[model samples]
Target: MSEKLTLHKYQSDITGLMIEHKAFGVFAEPGTGKTPTSLYVVNHFRQKTLVIAPIRIAYSVWPPETKKWSDFNNIKTGLLHGLDKEQRFLDDSIGIYIINPEGLVWLESMVAKHKRFPFTNLIVDESAKFKSPSSKRFKALKRVIGLFKRRYILAGNPMPNSYMDLWAQIFLLDRGERLGRTISAYRNRFFTRGGFRGYEYFLRPGAEEEIKDLIKDICIFIKATDHLDLPKLVINDIRFDLPKGLRKKYRVMEKQLFWDLDEGKILASSAAVANSKCQQIAQGFLFESLSDKQKYDKVTKKVYDLHNIKIELLEELVDELNGSPLLVGYWFRPDYDKLKKAFPKAVYFADSSKSEAVQIEKDWNAGKIPLLIGNIASISHGLNLQKAGNHVCFYTMVWNYDMYDQFIKRVLRQGNDNDRVFVHRIIANKTMEEAMIMSMQDKSAMSSGFLNAINLYREKIKEYDE
Candidate 1:
């Protein structure tokens, strides 16, 4: 008898889902086997799969990950990147074709004119990138969606701020199937007039039920934490207390801007103190007034206070593991600067060619740079850094949950000695950090829209069941 294929319950659920929904959505949390689950869906379809992911993810994630499972070495794969037409064609002719979303800017016009490609399926990995209707990438994706017979969008964080994100991804799968005849119809049905610049704007008004009903048939949503027999994923929140002096200053600024509602008065009240606070928070030393035309002058000296605190926190954990490499996720320029300066040899930078990024990845894999500092834009979605660091530290939070979730998943993946995936967020007390985290939890519910997408899935499933 053939060897029995083993799968986790959620993985099996996804495999079953593939038979039904031509376009499906997997909204599981980070570190819950989303990568493998997504690949299983592609493998089952047995088509010329075209995966669009971040460049780094396109280059690294699939190769090593696919190798971990069956002896499917004969399976062909190609990476479509750069501005090379001849190379892309050569690669696309073979197995799975992977391309970056940014590369769509160049290929969009070509695809429009040629209108011919061999792709059987177009998988929008990290579909949140196309959530914005105004983006050039969104237009490019729509133009190319017609070329592929089957379309699938994969994302953990689909809804960023509003239901507006639901429009673009759903359009790619089957336009007019969900929402309504147009994007405007869906917006007007669920939203009511709110506020604008001395004018009225529209907002969602208790429309969760309506939003859920709209996409009921086309999406598959699952949470890893809700499933059984899965390894334990412990999530913790770490809060930091601001110093007494800084707290007093923060309160005064907070009252002026929030309570008193005096923008000019607040600025005038603490001109010196505000500048100093901003500079210090920036991980730079003192703020100095310059004769430049720009309103905000640059920091003059090197401030080691923020670095000292970050290093102290990381070192405490790293020492416990006998100095095992720790992958530090940094986004802001100041965070990157502080991390790079504190550990000069460990920072990863993206170049035009992205060769530096590749080398840093290798060094990290080989455990050369134990303390790796990376930005989400530079290293978030596509790369696998799990071999080097099983532990992750977030200096601050980012607005995009796609980048945030993808970066952490890079470390907490399969084949590591980590007892538990350690994710630490060094959030400053009572700042945007708290609000950003809360927003992330809410925005990730874009996956829940799949419950609304069930009607579409039921149609497809009924056909398959017969």
Candidate 2:
């Protein structure tokens, strides 16, 4: 038989990661081979690897990739997704388990039924899901972390908001040693101002320096732009002029809201004031105050209308692209409506009522539908759509780095034979869209060591001065 399928670069990185027992974060971007790098680390340490990820991703990453890599086609791997089966040997040689975070909701009873072996290593892929301290998934992962001797938190973009790392992620890394034992302690030591209720610590500017120093011996940071053989990525920002009507409405509401506030004519709590600002952004109209029920009712209607606008834009863009199969990335519910209306025949994860999702995949590869749209969180991981479409378009920009990377790789993977893949970003001018683009560029560079890409971004920024 031929030499075992091996990517030496990935193997080298795995060695480094396995040697480090402290909490490690893999900042590798989409298509930079994080899965292989992680797998090799598991193989090197000869430890049981437990992967907690989204359901779709769990199916896409392990069995298929493992078959491609190892000579043993029936290597042992357990999927703890749906029904509980009696404890089974992964393979006589190795044990690998993959479970969706949703499964963790019933994990206590499940573990009781089938005694869980102490997990040697735990890999939390797409770790941004745990950023919210109050979320059930975050708490579930926290409980599961205790069973692992070593842990790895894999994310392309771990730090989005300032408060993210303090509670959820820091707890995973070292359980309060580097950051704090609790969110309150973390805030006390590293944060001081701009938090909720006017006294919380929100942003920690020196956190990066502190993190690197503390994990100096434990963590490894790798950027994709540092790799020589990786294909060059060219990111272009396609901005659309904002509708003049929207701008005028925005200004009229802004002036009226402040005028009312300045004259002491409006009396409301801080939450009411914040809600007014949110209304302006959400619907291009401002309300002095809205009860939670009113806000919820209004938000639902506005989102429905927003979905119409997205479909309109997508139809126009699809026409512009000459009907080439387009891969559309969405984030919100509004996106789903627009996508469904525009491509009635579209195969979507949410449309499970029509046909089974796995069967739909076969239809997709067979070229049944030309246009596909879904949230990046849903479509980005584990799926290969290289045969379906090469043109990727973002219905809206996303903040999470891993989702962005995985979204692009779904079409541009290694076995893909297509030429000249085009990525189109549909952004509304002078909105959060501008900020999202800048943030993604900065974070992508940080993850992938694309020195030239960084230089190009700086040059483009300098153009504004000239």
Candidate that would win on TM-score: 1
Error of 2 at 311 (Å): 4.4
lDDT tens readout by residue for model 1, 254-360: 33433321233332222323333432442322233445437446534333443246555555655676767777777656566656666666555532245566677
What TM-score do all the candidates reach, one by one? 0.75, 0.73
Model 2 Cα lDDT, one tens digit per residue, 1-466: 3226656575476557656665677755555667767777776676777788767667666655676576434446777765443343223344677777776666656566656564678888867668887788888777767778888877655654444453577578787777677877766766546423354343366865765676555555565546524334445456554456665554455456445534545432222333244233432222243345754754223321421344556678788877577888876565565567668876576665312544555556666657777778777766667666568888766655556877887776654556556788876554444544665766542212222332343445443321
Candidate 1's C-alpha runs over 4 A off are: 1-6, 66-71, 83-85, 90-92, 112-115, 195-206, 228-248, 259-308, 311-321, 347-369, 376-378, 385-390, 399-406, 413-417, 427-466
| Candidate 1 TM-score, C-alpha based | 0.75
Collision count of model 1 = 13
How close is each model in CA RMSD to the real structure?
10.7, 7.0
lDDT (C-alpha) at residue 73 in model 2: 43
Model 1 Cα RMSD, 1 decimal = 10.7
